[model samples]
Target: MAFFDDLSHIGFSTKDFYKSTELYEKLGFELIDQEDNLGSKVNFYQINDLILEVYEDKTNSENGAINHFAIATDEIDKTFAHVKKLGFELIDDKIMHLPFFEHGISYFNFYGPNHETIEVCQKNKE
Candidate 1:
């Protein structure tokens, strides 16, 4: 079966985490999940079924407005292998488990030729 399921969320890079998050809140979006890894912070907000993922960035050299877009998959290992076979180098190739979640979320982000990042993830589901 094809590993990919659906589009999970789209990520944006922001220098000011609280400022941007507040802006989203004013737009009727509410914080659903957030995680701080290393020095980087990732946040997920949702309005109805739409999800927007944002991350803190100290240095964003790219002019692109998008940081990365996530694709959901049921079989993350197979999906990761497929992306590897396509010759895309993965920046995140390990399991990332959050304290609030049960299963570990496995994912990888690869830079396209244009330097835009794309992520395929298998979310922790019961």
Candidate 2:
């Protein structure tokens, strides 16, 4: 079986999250999800199967650099355990949850060999 289902989304940390999201909207990306918590705001826009996650980060001066990329999984818990068994370092202590998509999503991140962030996530089914 495949470890991941598909490419979920690409995330960007920007100094002006609203501006970036607005630009994407004007380009025909439809806003699909948004959330605000812990003083951080994130917005998701989709064009077909491609999703773009934009979040505010005043400290991030680089406006367009990719913060991370996510791979979708149907079994996030099993995937988390398997990745740890393979000795991949976990970025989060445990799986994290977000009120995203329909029923929400569970996710976690690990650092690649080059220090790039890669997230594995599963969108819950209602």
Candidate 3:
């Protein structure tokens, strides 16, 4: 009955991208992917099966916290509809796409009970 496969990643906002990457690397996280999209640079790191996302946020003045978390879903459209039917406040008007990995990723965001951002994404593949 679960719509998501697993917790795909957790994101952190950083004012200094390079400095944050270096710090995460020292903490045993290996950089897996990087991209320049969404008006800023994003880097994905992995330590075992965990994917941690760090993205540039120059306007962020305070020390960062978990910006958002993503849940992996194979059936994006179906899940999106289900979430909508459940009446959760959706952040994205429609599913959004980004060139993230081998192919790309399509996702949408909705606010949780506490107004926390929760992203449901499907990583497109061949």
Top lDDT hit: 3
RMSD of each candidate relative to the true structure = 13.4, 13.5, 13.5
Q: List the residue pairs that clash in candidate 2.
A: none
- The residue-by-residue lDDT of candidate 3 on 1-126, one tens digit each, is 989896687777777787767655754568999999778999999866778878887887654555456767789999899888867779998999999999999999986433447688899985
Predictions in order: lDDT = 0.68, 0.75, 0.77
Q: Give the C-alpha miss distance for residue 10 in model 3, angstroms.
A: 7.5
Candidate 2 per-residue C-alpha lDDT over 3-103 given as tens digits, one digit per residue, 9 for 90 to 100: 99967888777676666665566545699999985798999888778887777777865524665667678989987887777676579979999999989
| Candidate 2 structure lDDT | 0.75
What TM-score, over all chains together, does every model reach? Answer: 0.47, 0.50, 0.49
Clashing pairs in 3: none
Off by over 4 Å in 3: 1-65
lDDT tens per residue, model 1, 1-126: 999885677777776677667655754568999999687998998865669877888687673357666656788777677767766656766645444447667677775433557676677686
